[model samples]
Target: MHGPVSAAWLLVALCAATGAYCLLRMRSGVEEQRLSAGGEALMGFGMAVMAVPTAVFTPPRWAWPLYAAVFGAAALRTLWAVRAAPRHLHHLVGASAMVYMALAMAVAPPGPHHAHGGIGVPLLTGVLLAYFAGYVLLAGARLVPAAGSASGGGSTAAAGIRAGAAGWGDRPELARACRLSMGIGMVTMLLTM
Candidate 1:
């Protein structure tokens, strides 16, 4: 009957725009890498937007199936990717948390699952946020000191070897930025809601 012309839809649109930009920034340069780290958080933010609306907007019969099919598929894909790219810890954690969010809502009573408010209320909301916040913080910690010197320069790469004046610290910034993006997006999503 009623389409999601609600304020929530606006949030989703904002998320989509942010997500795309994040994807792009992830490719920017060694200096922008810290920003790229935020991408995972952005992805989480996008998924949360989609989830909140679908859960709140869907009618009966379709709710469970929708949750299972969409979120489940995304989560599963992320999980598979995690195994395939075991080195990508951000992907792994982001996907795992997404799976947790899906499961959290899947069991709610029929129809407009999000209408209850309990799903996104303080408890679940806090947990969802904490996970993402921690994700961003981790990435920030990893990227600090050198900020934009992924051309090696970070403390993490200092011990290994040296490469020119930058001393391996001037590597790239995307990996680190993606990490921050994920966290920053989480804060944005949480604030928006």
Candidate 2:
């Protein structure tokens, strides 16, 4: 595999791991937790399929339409869920991006000419880059205090964690991390394209 392909595979692995963790958390018998399990799994699998190295496997023409349909449905679901919580908007954006990528790939020329550039491509890349950069910076900032406290004393970290005591599904930090991971993956995919 080449550099971009290798990076995509690494992202696939991370997304899969995150999805697996979310699935495990869903087993806790919490209604709210269960609601997101499907979305997480879909996101993971969708990214994996999109990231597959073209050398290893180039999806057939029909597959692109299928992917577009699947991600379109996912986008709709995420939009519906946004009424429950604003955070679901991020998921909507992710699914929409997937749809965009799928459509782009569907119309792309075959062979080495598949990856091309234009004003639209650069615009999308810039927007995605800005969003992911902000997300990572904000999330990293929030984690800083936690890291500092944890470094000061292990018990302090434990105490902080215990006080929070949220179910894995409800963890803001983990959710942020997952979003960041997906953002990075999206950016990587876009750049390769």
The segments of candidate 2 whose C-alpha lies over 4 angstroms from its true place after superposition are 1-3, 117-120, 151-157, 160-172
Model 1 scores what on Cα lDDT? 0.52
lDDT of 2 by residue, 69-126 (tens): 9999999989989988986787787788788888878887766444545435556756
* lDDT of each residue in 42-120, candidate 1, tens digit only: 4645454543565455535555455445545655665665675665555555554555544545555554323335444
Which candidate leads the pack in TM-score?
2
The lDDT for every candidate, in the order shown, is 0.52, 0.71
Q: Candidate 1 — worst ten consecutive residues by lDDT sum?
A: 161-170
* Candidate 1 error regions (>4 Å): 1-14, 22-48, 51-64, 109-130, 143-175, 184-193
